[model samples]
Target chain A: MDFLELDAVTKEYPNRSGPPARVMDQVSLSVRQGEFMAVLGPSGCGKSTLLQMAAGLLPVSDGTVRIAGRRIIAPPPEAVYVFQQYTRSLLPWRNVRDNVGFAIEHRLGRRRAREVAEAQLDQVGLEGFGDHFPWQLSGGMQQRVAIARALAAEPAMLLMDEPFSAVDALTRLDLQALILEIWARRRLTVLLVTHDVDEAITLADRIAVLTRRPARMAEMVEVGLPRPRDAVATREAPQFLALRRRLLDRLLLRHDG
Target chain B: MTAERLLRPLPGLCVLALILGGLEAAVDAGLIRRALLPPPSAIAPVLWDMLASGAVLPPLLATLRLVFAGFFIGSAIGVAAGLAMGWFPPVFRLLEPVVELLRPIPKAALVPALMLFLGIGETMKITSVALAVLFPVLVNTLQGVRGVDRVMLDAARTHGWGRAHTLLHLVLPAALPFILAGMRISLGLALVLAVLAEMLAGQGGLGFLILDMQRSFLVRQMYAWLVILAVLGLALNALFLLVERRALHWQPALRP
Candidate 1:
């Protein structure tokens, strides 16, 4: 059985002066255990909405999201959501260390949580910057703190919604490399949503292509790439180019329509 | 950095000196009546005498006591109510109409009503100050709590933080700038209402003394008390600014 399953998921929002408007249409996808799956789509697509549903942060209008064979009603303890807007997501009042500790501080006392946060920070290459506030760090560093926070939760799954889209290109590449390393080390199931074609192919074990608004999963293409991917070499390969072209063409078709 | 900090206020201090000098010149030249406005030099000695003789302590402490009690009580109630109203829809709906109606009527006008109920005592005076302090704080805190980023709230939920934990750690801190801004405005109102209540009640604080001295035609003493009140206001405002900057040190725009 899939580790996470979205079964015939549909989402609708109440309109100001009309019937409910649909944003996601009967989308169903499944993520296997220990897989790095990327949900790629055009801008303003309901990819993030689907990811939120799978994480159980949003109530599904007409379907069930099951994690570990259990129907998800709220955020399950085995999963954590990493937000794209790291600046807003992090508590500015908290130092980098405390923010990372936020995930486990309730279970573990402050002292124990801080120690765990420090270890997570080290993994994310943010050692010795624990005392600094989020505003004191650069955009990339702040996102690293956010990633550390997600990792500190020690969940079997990580749900990320366009997590690195806000940083500079060079910073984005660095983050991409960092994520690949983390994934290899942790062997955690990841469902990352993104609008970037290159990012989807570069990091994901499989790419789930999505259609435009009121979107549904179009197809799931296996990346079939080797483990421990490099930023430059991975992109330069033939398979990466072929997969990028196929996904871009599919997405562009919807854009043209 | 120390030099920069010291020099920061030089321009404002210079302007203040120029205004005081101009007022003194006008009074000395008889263009302004000394009976109406005492020169800085004349009031300076009286202020020094009051301070040195420890006569400044009583009235100063009394007024300070009223302001502090009202400000703290009012701020605490306002924050609690505001967070509830902002966080929970039912609470907001229940309180919205009553708050809007009560908020607009000047709290000073409520002073007479308060005096009628509580009579001319410290209770009446502090209550009046608290009423003045409450609404601004309540309104600002509500705004702040409501304006908290939705993403952050979602983050809190995903982290498995319960409602109480979220309110105390996440929601409260996120809304702090708004809460503090409201409290800053209320601090000034707290003092104003305290002084006003004291005068109206014919009480023993600085306000009453200023009024009493003027009526008795002790012009110098009245100006002297007025000067003390002005200095008190300036000191309180300076202290609040210092604390506010420190509390919001992490905010980039608020960094000192």
Candidate 2:
């Protein structure tokens, strides 16, 4: 059974003067428990809009998003969104530990929240950097804090929108490795949005290629690369190379042709 | 560390001393009449006596009380209204016209009107000072609130933060720097209004004494009260800066 499902979801942004601009045509997708699904598309392909709607952050102009067989209109307690701009999402005024704790503080209060936050920080390899503010941390570390914040909420589903796209290539690899390890340990169903073909091939259980603007799901390709994957070896796999080429062809056709 | 802080002002003090010494020399040489511009040497003794005897407390306290009261009242209302206006469209729409109508009118010009209603007492003076402090704070807070990053608000929503949680933890801290800036600008205006209101009131505080002494031909005493007012202004500004830095320790511009 699908743990999270986006059923024929369509998004249209209503403009002030003109008619509503359609962002995504009816796109259906579903993720089983403990599955990692990556939505691969070109830039400005409404990938973020799809993820946001699934997270219940943006309302779908058409269709329903169901989590655990229940339709969700607002952000569900079982899911959390990890934003791309980690710098903006992590409150600058708050230290790293406090920012992580922000997710659960209202429920657990300060002292308890800090203990939980520390454990989450440890899980994300940010153990000794708790008291440091977001502005003091590197971009990669800040994103780890953002992930730690989502983990502290103890969400069953993580909706990530190009979370590591801003970090350096080396840092992005480290983050990808970190997230995969965490995802396995926690049994989380993750829907990661990205434009990078290699990222989709390396991380996802299945890749959903989206066509550009008012995007529709062009194809869903199953990533058959063996589990217990490492970032270094995953890219060079014959299967990984094939999937990457196929996605690139599908994504680049409208641009070059 | 403390020594460096203490020594930092030495240069400005030296400049002040040089100017004072020049004035004293001119007075002693009889190039300037003593009645018109008394030497700093002559004014110093009166200042010392008033401070030593605690005679400066009454008027000093009166003016300070007015400034503090007006400042707090005005700031509290300004921040509250600014948040409401920024967060809610109806509040902004309803209050915009009235606020705009009142905000642009020079606050000092309202003194006669305040006197007409509140009489020539503390009430009139405080109302005048508070009016001066209100608009800048309100407008700045509104700007700050509106300027809050869209991503931050979106993050709050996705993280399961409720309206009050978002307002207190997110909205207020985000707008604090702007609110404090408005308060800083309004602090100087508050003092201006306090002094002007006191002068117009003509019955209490240092402003009255300064004007009264000059009219009474007590030149050194007038200058003495004037020094007290100057010190008062300097002290208030320094105190505000210290508090502002403490409150916004996270801000880059405010870092030491």
Candidate 3:
């Protein structure tokens, strides 16, 4: 069995004054144990809605989501989400360590959770930021702290929703590298939803292209790239450029149609 | 130093000093009659007399006690009810109309009705202040809880936080700023109702002291009590601001 699975998942949002809109239509996918899959689509394409359904944040109108052969009714502690707005994600009342430690303490006991949170902070290269509040940190640093919070839970699956879209391009590159390093080290099954094609190409093991509103899986392209990939090397490679061209062609063609 | 830090409070202090100095000068020069506007010198001596004899201390203590008790009780009920109403659509729809109906009725006007049931005692006085203070805190709390970002909520749920856990961990922390703002407004209202209750019930408080002095034609003493009330109000406001700053220090500074 696959590490994670989504079977014919459909989500429809009710409209009071109009016909109920179907956001996701018979969406289905699967993730292997160490696979990093990126779902790429235009805005309002229900890529986020798909991610939410997988995380069990939203109920599937008609389908099933399973993790390790077990059907998911709701979000379990083993699967965690990293949100896009890192600044608002962390509670303003809590310091960095406590925000990370909150889930740990709730899941584990106090003493054990604190140790795990500290270790996760270290893993994210945010060891000294434990005492600082979210507002005191820079945008990139805040996102790292949020990543640390999710990592502390030691979840098997990590779901990211446009996690670096709010940061500057330079910071986004740095964070992407950081995430890649972490994913390599932890071997986490990751499903990232992003509008940035370059980001999807750079990070994902396989890219799932999605259609616009009432979204369906359009295509899936495997990225056969070596580990510890450099940005310059990957972009310059003939195969990488070919894949990028192909994805862009698919996207622009969809737009024109 | 920041420009705002230096300039923000300057005009307010200047206006307050100018008003007090002008009032004192007018009274001293007989431009305003002594009975109508007692000079600072006269009022100072009367205030000193009351403080030295400890004539005002007991009632002042009693009034403080009542204010705090009412504030705690009313705030506890308001926060709990507001959270429930804000979280559940059915509960909100049911309670909103009743809350709106009762909110506008003058709190001071309810004093006579309360006195008939509880009599002119501590309960009546505290109840009056509590009723007056409850609405702002309740409304603000409800709004605050409702105003939490839907994105943040989804993030929490996706992280496997249950409904009850989300309320305590996410909703409460996010809603705290608005709740504190409401509490600050309620604190001032609490003080107002406490004084008003004393004045109307003919009981002993700073309000009663002012009334008694006026009846006896002790105009200077009445002015002195008024000064004390103003100071008390200022002190309470300052305390609320201090708490607010400490609690919300983690929020990033935003340009207005």
lDDT of 3 by residue, B169-229 (tens): 7898899989988999999999988998888885688888888889999888888888888
Candidate 1, B131-223: lDDT as tens digits: 899999999999999999999999988989888888888889999999999999999999999999989995688988999999998888898
Q: Give the Å error, residue B169, model 1.
A: 0.1
Q: Write the per-residue lDDT of candidate 2 for residues A47-147, one digit (tens) a residue.
A: 99999999888889999999999998999999999999998888988999999999999888989999999999999999999999887889999999999
Candidate 2 vs candidate 3, lDDT winner: 2
Q: Which lDDT tens digits does candidate 2 get at residues B90-144? A: 9999999999999999999999998999999888888888889999999999999
Poorest lDDT segment (10 consecutive residues) of candidate 1 chain B? B247-256
lDDT of each: 0.92, 0.92, 0.85
Better of 1 and 3 by DockQ: 1
Grade the docking of candidate 1: medium
Clashing pairs in 2: none
> lDDT (0-100) at residue B103 of candidate 2?
96
In terms of TM-score, the best-performing candidate is 1
Compute the DockQ of candidate 3. Answer: 0.58
Worst 10 residues of 3 chain A by lDDT: A102-111
Pick the lDDT winner.
1
Q: What is candidate 2's TM-score for chain A?
A: 0.97
TM-score of each: 0.95, 0.93, 0.93
Between candidates 1 and 2, name the one with more favorable TM-score: 1
